[model samples]
Target: MSATQSHRGVGSAVALPPLSNGPHRKRLGLVALIATFGGLLFGYDTGVINGALRPMTAELGLTPFTEGIVASSLVFAAAIGALSGGRISDGWGRRKTIILLAVLFFAGTLVCVFTPSVGVLVVGRVLLGLAVGGASAVVPVFLAEMAPFEIRGSLAGRNELMIVVGQLAAFVVNAIIGIVWGDVPGVWRIMLAVCALPAIALFFGMLRVPESPRWLVEKGRHDEALAVLRSVRSEDRALAELGEVENVAKEERESQQIGWRAVFSNKNLFRILLVGIGLGVAQQLTGINSIMYYGQTVLVESGFNESGALIANIAPGVIAVIGGVIALTLMDRIDRRKTFILGLALTTSCHLLIGFASMMLPVGNPIRPFVILFLVVAFVGSMQTFLNVAVWVYLSEVFPLHMRGFGTGVSIFFLWVVNGFLSLFFPSLVAGLGITGTFFLFAVVGALALVFVVKQVPETRGRTLEALEEDVTTGAIYLVHKNQG
Candidate 1:
């Protein structure tokens, strides 16, 4: 039960515990459903702008430059939220942090709905961004810590599924409101207002769910941790897992490697942080968010009129939800490394096809818009299916328990930063390079991402978080494949 003993056992075979059924399983399912409301809010807040932007531009007099500012301001703030939210969650506890985020979400939504000018709207978005970023960093970790290793992938992945579902809801609502109230002034406010309902739900929901058992253990509240664990796990398995967690937690405390200082000074911790950051960066560079935030613009450039593009944008959102469902089913069955490799390959190919279609079909061609739309949908579907959920789940589980929050927060900060830059400049890129040239650039970036995954990303599937933590902290994770080969 010592740290040395646990570290030595990292390479040994450890069987996954059987999933418990009955009330305990239902309790776990309900917790996942409630917590992922954060993901839902993240999706709706980020995606609502896709349809709302056109009408908002007309009413608010948003020049192209100012439009970029309005769109990306939330993303930039999210980067700040993500970096700080992780550390805050570590100190404040995951449950309390999520409750605070819910309050932010509701307040931010109200601000956006009521704001009369561009400046006020930007301020409102910054508030929402902080909540979104915090949820991105915290929700998956909460789910992962709560789940049994047997179903951790799917359970944690539900947050991503909820995210896409929220995005789809935004798209559907935008289409309904935009078409129905096409003549109504400030219809976009209604679109922004709908998210407040889920924010309220998340607040109340967190109050009912138990704090993460692993987090309770980390704080040295052993009896409480076991109590929470028993609600979701079989009693015998709960006790056994508690022992494993305590052994690792003890070693982490004894070593005194817990925060940013430890991350920088320890070579293994630093390498893994880089890997997490790399994964985050790679996911954003796929150019998926570019479509999510500006699908209407992209479709317009491909030849659809503004109204047509607004409706057409729903295609990608629908495909994204479907792909997320598919990905969740495969999460536990497939190797994490294989999912990354295949996802990168598929998404990169889709990018190339979209670029070529734009060049070869031309804007005036009758089929051009439809072709581009199809390719965009394919790109989104591939990303949702293979990259999005898998990346979040991997990031949540890859770090040592002591530094999980810091590592996840830092990695997702880079993710949001890349996404913000892309959102900010996508208009300029489209205006200058045209759809063909812009997507070609994304294709090139996608190719490089494929290389990064094949070379640097480690396999995390089918391992307990503690075992994975052991390998990650000692740098043994990188050598596992080679030794097996």
Candidate 2:
């Protein structure tokens, strides 16, 4: 599968033949790398707290109640961030909006690092949360718009890959710091500081990247859109894609106005939006994030001591990174529907396995913690490889260009809300029900989520975003694509 290369004016809307390789791929890769720094910061900011929370709790004199509040503040803020980010990107353009998010990320990190009181820390977390939520919604959409259809899945999925990589880095950093400076009073501040580097990186990196070409077309800057597409796409493909964008834009202009009213009034658009919402909500229901946020707690409850659990919590993060790599490889090759169905199947089974293991094994038994951890790691791997990338990519591509940002924002806002609720209540759930009851509940919810995907989710695997928009608006995208093999 070599991509054919040509040196031609990308700014001209001329049709060209398809081939793999060359400068176009390089430019696209560079753009993806830069844009995905947002994902790295998102991952780092969110995961840093997983290990930092214990130290932060001690330093802040937090109770279990205050601990939940501290931990969930960012998540609650993220919900608002997702909604506002969507509107900002739609109004201000994705590239510039990311630049603003970088500033917020930097400022928020400083606030958390320098804060003397819990109230100040909460304010800081909310600011950081806005950046995280914005990144989560915008990065994938930005990449999706930039990438050629042939490889859009893998390229867009890079954001998820970077996210897990960021988590892995946090885990490693926390482990090293925890081992060496186990008694340090302000170790959490150092953990929070690591996020600032990526924030600075993203702020500068985006300067070199072009705005989304489709977005330019949406805003009536067709010439600038062509220039951007030319830099990253072959002359022929750029023209073809730009033509598609024009047609869609023309259709949108003729048919309806785009906003909250259009989204709710149009049945097709509303249905697709509901699908995005379902995917967002269903992904979080798997309990993957609970492990991400509180891996140490789960491990300690299973059997390991505090120190052992802190160090041991890195296992899931490692598996998450590995699984993300595998997912990127599979993204363009596999059907979206298959990935979701298989992921939910594996994760659901892992949940059941964890619950049963906890029920059967006594806490004093040495094998108990290891078995539960094994299942948790397996679940995380299944999720990263199959579900996370698929869901994010699908949401980014499913909406019409007019509503892409708004639709994804609304969907992810709910996703963050679910994430916040779980982050807040998970400790209580664990403390009250123990591992068995908690996991069984996840298994039940996962089973239901699997059913939803099997029934309602559409296949977006080989289609261009414009083609997808066409099918989705006509409500023809719900059918599954079967392989000729």
Candidate 3:
């Protein structure tokens, strides 16, 4: 293949053939749309708490400690969900696991919307958290497995976009509800209730989509895998791709190291697992979720009144959507490593600026809140554009098929764990350290994240999953760095 053709595949020597302008393309688009509803739910469920928490706190007479427990419970449960979801999807099939998650989303939403006490709310949140974490682990992998390598990044990235869109939707819904019914008791329940509609949609929508072809091949179901592939790919491409996948699956099976054992027995697999965990941890430590879960609190501390802060929280949600759109456009055009490097750098700079602005402006300054808000918005934009979508897509791609579910689950488990702890203690951190000290702490962490990316992250763009798998399993991916030096 010429360089031009191969560039479409990012860096692969073998270029994929042009997709047929057939119904298969439309089918692929439909599948992506339906599957991304899982992401939408993930976003809405997580972000709704940003605005709803205060109202719920008032209704239930929650203390800061109880509020933290209510908020962190879902996140902590999600950590468990991510771990189990991966294993379940690996055994139960991706499509089926998603369907199960849809059920969980619905059940959890009901629990939250109707719960009379904090205890019941915590129970609800845990259910929702499981669904959210499962979606986090499974959705991107499902998308990647369904897509051709040529446009895999964008395809997989659509879930992240949906996630942000869902978050934006939550912010918008929360603002409208809070503003329109500011005096109404239990209005936060309405905010949570909105999540149930999408859960219903995802359940029915997933029923119409085919299972992941790569996953089917992994289970030795060649005919079924081919059928699924044919629905999304052209006739010749489906056959060829199936053959390639089968070859890789055969090699994986013959090696006889699967799941955690594969990771432990093979040095390369273990290294990749560590890399996956590192990426997940690094992404969370950037403090993005701290804002997502508690933007209203941050804004109030910065200087905005409660209502104004509720409204202003929408700004980050809006920019996040915009950034996600731009990221989807760039996913195929830019290399994954470059995106990580740039995202970390931009986010770190924004964190430092936010800290310094808070310090210089102080509490009484008229412009302190606006300046801080603008910096927070900038930080979110940088994260969505450069890191969030890219990290999810890369995690979905890096693991070999045999261990993909386990690997992604384990990695995102840590991601959610870190996120849960941060969400739990962020309010306390800010109360103790104030905005300047808190953000300065984030800045320090962001700087360290940058170093980790530059040192350890590898380029995965422009390669087939199977090709990438070969490189990852054999440790040849590390050679790229050595060769560059």
Candidate 4:
């Protein structure tokens, strides 16, 4: 059968036009929003600890090293979750994978909220970390697969925006909870429990959402896949998409091997995997997580009282959300490479300024908190505006469709592993070198990342996933080979 004929008649049914109307758009948005609640839980579980940690440490008698362990335990678990979530999503389908994540989210938070010992707390955090890792990997892929190519960036971009919104929500909640019941014996429990609400919402909402059509095609449920496609897209467009998806799924099946080993054996796939991992690692090195997980601590160390630091910590969250809003508007217009380079440059400058100010400000000086706080906010703004959305979008889009899930999972696993170590050792780094020394290290990493982004990253702002996959998998993107071929 010809390509056009096969697409026009799927098995035996006539191809219908794609749906592009109110009901379909609303359903798509609702699904995206539900999956994003996992991001919200991720942000809150991680960010709430920033403010809650001080009081929790006092109550639980944690040492600096132990503090690092406690904070990083979740991140380490998340690495495992990220590594595994992709394979699971591939096997189980995106909707079911996320529904499972919701269960983990609720259960993990419940354990953390009531834990009496540090060991138990660590266990709970590890569980939460797994959920976070899964959410981070699956949410973007699910959105990218479901969204139309024209709005794919914005729709997939929405998950990252939701993550920051979740982080901001955590910050605001911490501030309010810390102030209203400041002297309560277990105030941090309240901060942690707040995530339960979102977790429940995610699980219930996902029960009603449709499974990803791509997953259906991969599983050889072609008619069901076409039905799903028809729900969101016009019938003709949906059939066209399903045909393309079916073709790629067939290619993947013929390849018959998909894993880290296959990815490494193909030198070009290796390069793409490296780029994905590099982007994840680079995104973390910007030190944005430091703020989310320890913003209040950083502010206090900069010389503010508990009350003042709690209040001041909200600034970055506010700016981050605003930057995210701007990013949504600009994502379609901007080049991915340029936005990434710009983010690295701006964030690197912020790190240097922060480190310099910390060194220049004498202990007990009034200006120190204000200066460091401003710089921190600047860093968050730069990251939210440029790197966060682009990194996730690129990682999701850069790989051949055959390896998208496994590749993203591997890259994100290493990404979270690096983040785990950083979170674990950050306080020690601060203790040994002070804030100036700490941020100075970030500045060095940022400079290296900027060089990597400008020289190696590809532009992916306005291409369909099929187009991108074809270009990327064939080595068409590298300038040296494009004309030679």
Candidate 5:
């Protein structure tokens, strides 16, 4: 065994070995680019609706209640998608699962682009939702399983970057189409159609990428796992890593009581899964999607004209992309728990400030909209910078290799469900409660989320997946990092 040095934290010392050295940067970078196309599809499909919805409602003769349903339909389907996709990826392998998602993306976009009725359009959105949910569940794990421990954060976080970039693409596309062809019937279809080109690219691109080696080992394909590992790591390191992985897989198989029953029967596995669920639910409760989904309405309610709100909506998307970039740079450098806590803190504060500003400023004040907009943008920046990437990375890493997909799926299922319900009822929420009330509600949730992170979330930086897996399987990973510096 490698020599270990004792690192002191608040009340204990952890003798952690050095993290695995990074592997071929160029090889891994290319793999990330291919995998993250799923994220792009995710961002575009969800966000295109942001700008496209206003025109869509007018064309479809949608009631406000129906508007919420149309918006939430994709999200509800995404919940199912994340659940099913997680299980599918666990069985089918991550790379193949992603390829399937690409096909769904293409078909979903095509359906939405041509749908003449509300019913058909919803079916398309649900298809797109499946693609989005699958991408969200699998891409991070794909990257995580491929990455070296030392740089896993940055490498895995590229999916979040791609997601936000896709969102930004939607915002920009919606703005262009809205400006040039705003009055044209079915311009919204053009916005939805933009996703199809990338889907084709994703399908073709993934054909050349390798499957996750850890998953290969889990399936008893040791030789195949070694072969995949060699392309990403030095030959000697690849062999060493394979040896470690084989040992774990053997222990898991020997223990062999797996499935939902096994997961619950094992206390450590169940506890960690709950933490993952908490993280997922907490993220959505921040209310970030409300802005992404109903931003124009929020902006208009804050006083801007519809045209101006469409243009101004781009600001949050721009900040989201920029925040994603900054987040990618910081992931490997910062401890995961701190980033999460800081994100929740900032997000919560923004909520309170937004609520307070809206109340004090009231309606019709020229500065009220601008101030609330600024706070909302600030909240988006905080979330994209700290919360989004870290939460995804944490979900990818916390589960045992045997159950990574299922665990992440269940957690994210709840996340998407929370997101869906919020999206579904947000128009109602705003109408019932208005900006001040809605924001204060977010503020309350944000405060509780802040506490959850500080008390429950574990730090996962600078640790090998294998090492983390060992600790997690034993319940030590949770206890060790819960208070560690």
Candidate 6:
């Protein structure tokens, strides 16, 4: 092909493919949707704890500190899960790894549903965390590799969309259970047990989806990779993609040493890892999960009762899904760096709004709940639309083929660790400092994260993964300093 033709083909693969009229394209889209249920389960489990904790605390007699532990233990374990998940996916294949995560999800949900003590509950949560971490690290990679570059952003983005959907699912389910079965001593168990249903769906779904074609190439199964790619893409497109994957694999093996060590040995790789971790940590520091995982309780403490809080929490979930839809539309249009920086700025302002609202509107004020809840929704909307999908897509796309797993694992591990710590202490922070102080702290972190993102991150939109990898691996992005220094 001529250079112009080659550029066009690569562009089609990278941009979101326009809605297709063909059966094959439709089939591929459906397959992507089905496989993304893993993302859904991940979103649900993490968010369910937000509302479930209220009843779980009462039943389990959890102190504020213990409640923090219960909430955060899974986050800590998820870091382990994200780290280990990469190696496992690299070896077992993405499909098998997802199936394994489904099993963990089922078992963890069962443990939590039946547990009589807080220790057992925490154990179940840790197991669940492992699955969450693994899914977070692997699912986006799986989707990205499987999707046509044309629609890759939106298709790979579907996982993030499912994440918000899952959160919405959790909010809806928690509300129904809390309101209808509010009198039950252990209603929280039922809330958690609901996760098992999706776990079952995800397990069976994985059995049907093919392994990632890029993974097959990494394992030297080029024929198999091409076969898998052909199922989702045109024959010409599949062959082209296969060549790209193989070329990268060949160059990667020549260096003969590609792993987490490469992250440190190569300054460029190390810089990419730092950027990845910064994105993950910054995404968390926005306190998105704090809202998703604890929104109901926050609403309750702000003055709404159990039923009112459950009903009110839906606002954020609704906005989250809406934001995700908006993100899907903008994934290809907005520069990734700008979206993230904009997200931090908007979310920081929301935090300030929330803090000020909480402080100005006394507990007795009827407007307190609406104002705080609306601001929380605004925060969730801004985050889901910008940072959430962009970070995952960038992580999945930026790394070279050989070290993709390790790079993603390192990034997500720290992401989950921060998430875990935040999950653990946020409630206590809220308890001790009240909403104003807690949000003030988030605002400060948000500002700091904004600075880091603006200075360190690079634009990744409209570039093929291979092109991005080439730029990243060669220190091309940072080469401007060659003359300056």
Local distance difference test values of all predictions, in order: 0.91, 0.88, 0.92, 0.83, 0.88, 0.83
Local accuracy of candidate 1 as per-residue lDDT tens digits, 78-104 = 998898889998888999999999999
State the lDDT of candidate 2 residue by residue for 1-485, as single tens digits. Answer: 13332111121232335845779889888999999999998888888888999999888898877888888899989999999999899999999999999999999999999999999999999999999999999999999988877788999999998998898899889988888886988999888888889999999999888999999999999999999988987787788778877977888788774666788787878988998999999999998888998899899999999889888899999999999999999998999989999999999999999999999999799899899888899999999999998899988888888899999999999999999999999999998999999999999999999988877887887766776776776666653222221
Better of 2 and 3 by lDDT: 3
Model 4, position 485, has a per-residue lDDT of 24
Model 3 earns a TM-score of: 0.97
Query: lDDT: which is higher, 5 or 6?
Result: 5
In model 2, pairs of residues that clash are 2-20, 3-19, 3-20, 3-21, 4-19, 4-20, 10-230, 15-236, 16-236
Q: Give the CA lDDT, 0 to 100, for residue 331 in model 6.
A: 86
TM-score of each: 0.97, 0.95, 0.97, 0.93, 0.95, 0.94
Query: For candidate 6, what is the lDDT?
Result: 0.83
Who is ahead in lDDT, 4 or 5? Answer: 5
10 residues in a row with least lDDT, candidate 6: 1-10
Best by lDDT: 3
lDDT by residue for model 3 (213-297), tens: 9998888888999998888889988887887788778877887866678898999899988889999999999999999999999
Candidate 6 per-residue lDDT, tens place, 113-167, comes to: 8997988988999999999999999899888878755566788888999998998
Clashing pairs in 5: none
Candidate 3 vs 5: which has more lDDT: 3
Residue 175 displacement (Å), model 6: 1.1
Which sections of candidate 3 miss by over 4 Å?
A: 1-16
User: lDDT (0-100) at residue 294 of candidate 2?
Assistant: 88
On the 0 to 100 scale, the lDDT of residue 464 in model 6 is 58
lDDT score for residue 146 of model 4: 90
Q: Lowest summed lDDT over 10 consecutive residues: which window, candidate 2?
A: 5-14
Count of backbone collisions within predicted model 4: 11
